[model samples]
Target: MDLAVLRPGELTGADREVWRALQSEARALGAPQLANPFLAPEFTLAVGRCRPGVRIAVVHEGAGPVAYLPFERTALGVGRAIGLGLSDAQGVVHRPGFHWDAQELIRACGLSVLEFDHLVEGQEPFGSRKFPVFGSPVVDVDRGFDAYLRQLRARSSKFVRTTFAKERKLGRDVAPVRFVHDERDPAVLRTLMRWKSAQYRRTGRSDRFAHPWIVRLMEQLFHTRTESFTGLLSVLYAGDRPVAAHFGLRSPSVLACWFPAYDPRFARFSPGLVLHLRMAEAAAADALAYLDLGRGAKDYKNSLKTRELTVHEGMVMRRHPVALGHVARRAPVRALRHAVLARPELSGPADRLLKRVGRLRTGR
Candidate 1:
C-alpha cells in the first residue's frame, strides 16, 4: 500500500477527488456512526486551517483511493486524532475491503503513539484495539420525526410527556415558545459561545470556545454552506429570548451534535431537551437520517435517543518507548473514567467533585 501524508488544506486535484469519493463510499456503509461528516475533507481542512499540524493520510493499494486518516502530530513523536478534544468520531474512513494492520499504518505515519477519545467503533485495524466501548445516544430521524416520537412514546412515555409538558410550560410562562432549527444570526452563535464557556467553567471542563482557533472554526463552519457538510445552529427562543441552542456539523443525512448550551435562567424549562426534540423534527424534515449526540452520558441523551451507537476511547501505538509512556499516561485515566461511568455511585461523587472544583475555579 502507498500512503501519502499532506496537510488537510493541501488535499487537492486528484487527491481531493479520491477523498470525496472515499467519503461518499464510507457514508454509504449503512451505519449512522460510521458516516461521520467530520472525516470529510471540508471539515478536516477547516480545522487544519485553524489549528496547524493536522495531517491527512491517504492510503492506496493499487489505483483508486481506499482510506483516509487525519491526525495531529504532537511533540515527542506522539500523534492524536485530528481534533482530539473536539472531534466526536475518530477513525480511518476506508472501504470494506481495505486492508488492516495498525502497526504498519502507525509506522508509515511516523508516529510512536496515536490516541483517540471518541473513536468510531467498527473501524478495521484500529477497531481491534479499541478500549471499552461506550454508548453514544442517537436519534434516527430518517423515517420521520412523528414516527420517532411514536417510538419514543412507546419506549419511555414519561420522558416524552414530561419534556413536551416542559416545553409547553415554557411557552405559556414565558413568551410563546419558538424553535428555529437552523438559526443564521452570528450574534446567536456568540451567545452560544458565552453560554458554553460559562457552562464549561461551571462544570470544571476546559472552556473550548476560549481557544481562539475553536472560536474561528465555529465561525468558519457557521458560514460554511454546503449540502454535504455545513454548520447547523439550532435555537429555542421564548419571544425574543433565546433559551437553548445547539451548534453542530452535518452532512446531507447526519448531524454531529457538538456544542449545546442553554440559558441557565431557563433551566427549569428544560429548554435543552426541548431544543433537541425540535432539532430532531427539523433534521428529519430536511431529509437527515441521524443526530449523533456524540459520546458521553447525559440524562437528556438517554431519554431522547431512539438507539445507541458505540464509540471508543484509547490509543493505538507502535512498539516504541514513548508508546508505553503514552499508554501509561492515558490508560489509567480511561480506566477510572469507565469505572466511574459504569456505576452511578461512583459517577455521582465524581460529578460532585468536578462541580466543586469548578465552583472553586469560578470563585462561585
Candidate 2:
C-alpha cells in the first residue's frame, strides 16, 4: 500500500478518474450520493474556498486508488475532515472491503490527531473508540406527501393536526398558499440566510451564514445541477413575496434539508411549518425516498420524523508520543467546549456572543 498526503492543486486527472470509479462502487454498496460530494474534486475546491488548509489523502494498492480522505490541517497539528459541520454524512470515500485502519491513516498522514464532527455511522474504521453518538431524523416521502402525512398522523396525531391547523390559519389570515419546490430565485436564498442568521442569534448559536465563504458556496451551489445531487431552493410565497424558504440538496432518492427560514414578520402564519409541509409534498411528487432533517433535536424534527438514524464523531490519534500528548491536552478542552455549548443555559448567551463577534468580524 502507498499512502501520501496531497495538496489542493496536486489532484491529478488520474486521481479524479479513480475517484469517479470508487464512487460507483460506493453507490453499488448502498451509500447515498450525498456521500459522493465529499469525495468529489469540486467539493474539495469548495471547502478550500472556506479553509485553505484542505488536504487530500490518496490510498493506493498497486497503483489503484482504494480510498480517499479529504481533510483540513488546523493549528497545533490538529486535523479535521473537510465539511465537518456542513456535511450530513461524513466518511472516507472508499470501496467496500478496503481495510485501512484510522490510526494507521493518521500516522501515514503524519498527523497527531484527526477529528470529525459528523462521521457517518458504520463507516468508522476505528470502531467504538469514537465518542458522542447522535441520531438524525428523516421523513420518507416515497409513496407521496399524503402518505407521509398519514404516517405522521398515525405516529404523532396531535402534532400533525396542530401543525396543519397552524398552516390553515396561516393561509386564511396571511395570503393564498403558494409553494415552489425548485425555485431558482436568488431573493429566496437571501431570505433564508437572513432568517437562519437571526435564528442563530436568537438561540445563542454561531451563525453559519455569517461566513462569507459559506454564503458564496450556497450561491454557487444554487446554480449548479448534477444528476446525483442538485441544489434545491424551496419557497412559500404569500402574495408574491416569499414568506418561508428552505435551501437544501436533492439526490434522486433523498432531500438533504439544510438551511430553512421563515419571515418573523409573518410569525403568526407559521410559514416555516407551512414550507416544510409543502416540501414534503414536493418530495413525494419527486419520488424521493427520504428527507434528512440533519442532526439536531428540534421540536419540528421530532414531530415530523418517521425514524431516526445514528451518527457519531471522534478523534483518532496516532500512537506517537507527540500525538498522545496533543490528544491528552486537547481532549479535555474539546470536552469543555461541548459541555459549555451543549447546555441549554449557555445557548442564548453563546448565540448572542457569536452574533456580536460575527457583526464585528463582518460589519453586517
The candidate that wins on TM-score is 1
User: Can you list the residue pairs that collide in candidate 2?
Assistant: 204-351, 205-351
Whole-model alpha-carbon lDDT for candidate 1: 0.85
TM-score of each model, in listed order: 0.94, 0.84
Show the lowest summed lDDT stretch of 10 residues, model 1: 25-34
Model 2 CA deviation exceeding 4 Å by range: 12-41, 128-130, 320-329, 336-364
Query: With candidate 2 superimposed using the best TM-score fit, by how many Å does residue 15's alpha carbon deviate from the native?
Result: 4.2
Candidate 1, number of clashes: 0
Most accurate candidate by lDDT: 1
- Across residues 1-364, which tens digit of lDDT does each residue of candidate 1 receive? 5888887767877876676666655656654455677877778888887987789888887776778898998767799998898888888877776766888888888899888888886775775443777788899999999999999999989988999999999989999999898889999999999999999899988888889999999998899876467898999999999999999998877899999999999999889999999999999999888899988888888888888888777788888899998888888887887888899999999899989989999999
Q: Tell me how far the alpha carbon of residue 333 in candidate 2 is from the true structure, in angstroms, after superposition.
A: 4.4
Show model 1 residue runs off by greater than 4 Å.
127-130
CA lDDT of each candidate? 0.85, 0.76
